[model samples]
Target: MNTFHPQYLNDSQGNTISVVIPLAEYEQIVKQLDELEGIRLHVNTHTGKRPSIPLDEFVRQRMAFSKPIPPAHNGEPIGSPLL
Candidate 1:
């Protein structure tokens, strides 16, 4: 077994768990990891953070806060000479 050679292993959930290989495998593993990173970077570059509030949801929230309630009547307008 090459001291630096390696082999990939997976867990029960199909996730990469460990790598066991000689030094020769280092380059390949590094390349794969780099490719994965590149893909991630590319995706992030293309797609930025998604808007948390959609247009309709934003309008609804704005309206809820901006609506005015009718003034309470005290039986008559103040200073109108009538109660």
Candidate 2:
């Protein structure tokens, strides 16, 4: 049970236009939204009648079919080989 203290911003006519919350609260909200999105995706995928493969087999199949990424240059970070 999380509680937030939000401040309202108004326009020239004093009509509320937006709400502001603390930075930490904003970050928490974003994190919760990301988690909720992951949950929603998982639920949607599982609700289908399609057959599923073991995680290892799925990873293997994906890796076998995926094209290799070109190497990063000029000190750039390298992409994951498994991606």
Candidate 3:
């Protein structure tokens, strides 16, 4: 994991309200979160199944049914695209 240098946003009373990290770190975090979610979903879906497959195979199967994440374009978001 990359070491994050986060900037804290403080409220009027000096209470930390939010943290801002580098964009690269933020993107990496988001990607990791997505992967964790995928793993969680895969586990939930296969809880009682008779046969089991590898994580990569499960991810491939899931991706086969899901829409691909659109490439970021002109400052557009990763998953969402401007139609």
Best by lDDT: 2
Q: lDDT at 18 for candidate 2?
A: 100
lDDT of each: 0.66, 0.86, 0.79
Candidates by lDDT, descending order: 2, 3, 1
Candidate 2: where is the Cα deviation over 4 Å? 49-65, 68-83
Q: Is candidate 1 or candidate 2 better by lDDT?
A: 2
Q: Is candidate 1 or candidate 2 better by TM-score?
A: 2
lDDT of 1 by residue, 56-78 (tens): 77777777666454454965434
Q: Report the error of model 2 at residue 31, Å.
A: 0.4
Ten residues in sequence with the least summed lDDT for candidate 2: 74-83
**Cα-based lDDT at residue 51, candidate 1:** 38
lDDT of 1: 0.66
Clash count, candidate 2? 0
Best by TM-score: 2
User: What's each prediction's clash count?
Assistant: 9, 0, 0
Backbone clashes, candidate 1:
9
> Comparing 1 and 3 by lDDT, which wins?
3
lDDT of 3 by residue, 14-80 (tens): 9999999999999999999999988887887788534568878877777777775656777565753
